[model samples]
Target: MPIPRIHEIMEADQRILNAFSPEKLHRLGQAIGLNDSTTVLDLACGKAEMLATWARDYGISGLGVDFSEVFVADARDRVRELGVADRITIEYGDARNFSPRQRFDVACCIGATWIGNGVEGTIELLRQSVTTQGLMLIGEPFWRKAPTAEESVEMGFSADEFSSSLHELVARFTACDLDVVEMFISSEDDWDRYVAPKWLTMRRWLEDNPHDPMFDEVRAELTNSQLSYTRYQRDMLGWGIFGLLER
Candidate 1:
């Protein structure tokens, strides 16, 4: 199954696709000190919810780049619905190859760091798009408690897939010449909000598209996700959005 199609089915009802709430997202924008003059560059911006909401609330202008045709369309619609079309631009393309003519005041790679390979490389990528001392917002996952090799394998993750702890995650930023100014750690409630909705969405999709080519795969994926969430993810996994200032 196509990755984008899988995401489309799972997150059909979600706007901010990461394990974040609208309130927390807005608080993050405030913590970062957004204003009318702020220029932002959002990479892998699913639905562009952060940009759209910030534009409405803070009057910030920005560009959002995404690869998912489904998400790009929804993002465009979201901007228009929010009446921030004049402040936000949604671009459809590979974020890894995006080259901005002018650096932005903020650069974000929320929940989609694979565009630059991983955390370290992603920090480097975002750095190139922002002005000196600009902020970089990175949404990353970490281990709440270290899992054994067996558990890691069962989670379909490599040994180095995530930072060992939240402190380690901050250290990774410092190693790249960035300062962790602030962070918003997702609570278990946030995790539930992000994961539970997918079950219903996937089930409904399966019911309506029994004859679809990707039906079986989607069902199996959904089953695995439910099992994994119950068995390991809920307690062992954690996610956070870190605000980093270039040093």
Candidate 2:
């Protein structure tokens, strides 16, 4: 069986994804010049929060694609609940190879660039979804400063794989012929919002499945991550939502 996803354990608390406030999303929309008729493709869209927000707030029509069946169903339910089912469609598919019949005015890959293997590769992948003069939004992690090799390894990055500085990140976009249009940086609070709840959810799951052998591995991984995060990443790294346009 495939390893269980973190979301599988905390499916009950959908609010955890609300780390990006509506206001922040609206600001991102404005930065990207979203409109009532904009067609967006959300790559690796988890629960379709960004898609739902855009449909409701900006009147943009879009499709959200994700690999998780549970997340796709949740996103579909959210679209129905918001009464914007007509504006947003949710699909279960891999973002790396999804191809839509229609092109999009905007394409987004938020915090899941692994779909493209890496930053430059993700930009290339998103370009296939965009129409002429369209916007591409990439949410990525960057170091606030150079991290020690030890710090990189502690943060789950290979010594050679971690980005050394923010400039390197921007350089990758520039090299891909993508212009940096706007960005929203995530604060420490945002990281907390995304990660802290995992602990509680995992603890509850462990209580309910005390005899499950996998829980031991999950517990150990979570504990190590929690301690390492507090010790190393809390103030060391940063993430941002970047809006890029074709040069």
Candidate 3:
């Protein structure tokens, strides 16, 4: 399992500092069709920024579940800050086994769909929370083309494990009885926004706390990742946020 990095950086000002920007958030919201009456079940909702935005701007009511204690607490605080605590509820729990007591109008498992093992598994997991006609939103990665085995390895993916074609992704969703209603593909600029800032954050942290034991490790990893990312991911892989409805 991947370590929860968001939790380690959960501060009021830095809550989503390393994540996507407000423009990206707005685009995702538009892609997911968030509206005033939409009731969302946000699985793996880190800090609940999306949920809070939906509730505050769109007047959506929903529940958000995440395993990270820091994220959950921050989410709660954010809801209070937005004065929409009544519209959203956050819980500390794993998304894999979560089953809400009531159904929702929309079920979303964003970038952290690995909680259900994969995209298909995530859809099955979310079925428990979605109403019969509700939508399922999934955020996933796809390669722009078939990547070389060495390239896949460099990106932290097993050569055969994480490699998937766009056609196969669509086929998998179709096979699972989902109709693709909409999709928002992330551009290279989006990748730049998501990844480039981490280098700066890590560099700043390392410079400020050179005496820390983990400083070298953090610096090395960030440097390596920044270098490898341009070669392996920026030119090769693409990401998308997709919305599916029952077929």
* Whole-model lDDT values for every prediction: 0.92, 0.80, 0.78
Across residues 193-238, which tens digit of lDDT does each residue of candidate 3 receive? Answer: 7777777777777778889877767877787778788878788777
Candidate 3 lDDT at 130 equals: 95
User: Ranking under TM-score, best-scoring first?
Assistant: 1, 2, 3
Among these predictions, the greatest lDDT belongs to 1
Which residue runs of candidate 3 sit more than 4 Å off their true CA positions?
Answer: 1-21, 31-33
- What stretches of model 1 exceed 4 Å from their correct place? 1-3
1 versus 2: better lDDT goes to: 1
Instruction: List, in order, the clash count of every candidate structure.
Output: 0, 0, 0
lDDT of 3 at 198: 71
Tens digits of per-residue lDDT for model 1, 42-119: 999989999999999999999999988899999999999999999999999889898888899999999988988899
In terms of TM-score, which candidate is stronger, 1 or 2?
1
